[model samples]
Target: MKYLLDTNVCVDYLSGRYPAVTRRLQAAAPDDLRVSSVAVAELRYGAEKSVHKQRNHERLDVFLREVACVDFDRDAASAYGRIRAALEAKGAVVGPYDLQIAGHAVSLGLVLVTGNVREFRRAKRLKVENWRRG
Candidate 1:
């Protein structure tokens, strides 16, 4: 199964906070690992603002090299718009970046691995798996 590692999952793995999930992630086939551009952007944003900026930056680089970075292409962008509209129509206030990530996962047919399941749960169409729960 293709797994799209979410921002929080990546953070937990890098910080060694979730050893079980980290071990599973390490043991998984490299070809099965994926990450959305939104997650990469979030990591970069965190690294830029972190007190240990250099260390976090290095860690993010290594993580990026290990996983395939899925870009937000035309299809994914379209999906994002649809997801946003649908959620808004349902009276949900979904964050822009979260919608983008959800859209990318849906467009790529990837199961999102995240800790913040409730946030992404707003986009019910996107398949999400909480590594912490597993």
Candidate 2:
């Protein structure tokens, strides 16, 4: 199955904070993995604000080279609007970037790999998996 790596998952993988997440990523076929452009933006923002900005940026560069980055296009925008409206109607709110990543994943039909399962659960018809759990 195809998987979309969330920002948190990517952070854990890069920091080696979660061995299971790292292992799962290593074990998966390269073509089966993807990173949403929204997630990339989040990562870049984190890197830019880090104490070790240069080091973090270099690490992000290396990681980006290994995984494919998918753009959030018109279809993803439609998905985002639908997801946001549905969540608001239910009084369930997901973070702005998280919602964008969710929309990207849902638009492309990819399972979202994240550590924040409860937060992502707010999005309907979006499959979420926590690789940190092994």
Candidate 3:
């Protein structure tokens, strides 16, 4: 099984801040772990904003080495369109990046691992697991 980790989950795992996500990583196959380009961008965005930019960049480098990055391409755009419409029609609000992450997961047929489950669950047909909630 494969999981497209949300930005928050990616940061949590890379920083070794969450025991649950860390344990989940130890149990899962390294190859089965994946992340989207949007997530990479999100991580970099966070790193740039933090006081310890150099340290964060080092951590991101290590994280990037271990996890494979999947691009946000045409198929993800199509998935975003569908998910956006679905959420709009239902009056559900999600952050733009979260929507993009969800789109990437749906497009790739991978379960989305996120800490913000409430917003992600609003995205119809997108499977979400909260690795941070354990």
Writing each residue's lDDT as its tens digit, candidate 2 over 17-121 gives: 999999999999999999999999999999999999999999999999999999999999999999999999998867888999999999999999999999998
Q: Each model's C-alpha lDDT? A: 0.88, 0.94, 0.89
Name the regions of candidate 2 deviating beyond 4 angstroms: none
Please list all clashing residue pairs in model 3, or write none if there are none: none
| Clashes, model 1 | 0
Q: Which pairs of residues collide in model 2?
A: none
**Maximum-TM-score candidate:** 2
Q: Let me know the TM-score candidate 1 reaches against the reference structure.
A: 0.94
Which residue ranges in model 1 land beyond 4 Å of their true spot?
none
Task: Kindly give the stretch of ten consecutive residues in candidate 3 with the minimal lDDT sum.
Answer: 88-97
Name the best candidate (by lDDT).
Answer: 2
lDDT of 1 at 122: 82
Tens digits of per-residue lDDT, candidate 3, 1-134, equal: 89988999887888789999989977898899998999999899999999999999999998888889999999998999889888988888778888988999999999999989888888877999998766
What C-alpha lDDT, on a 0 to 100 scale, does residue 45 get in candidate 3? 92
- RMSD over all Cα atoms, model 3: 1.0
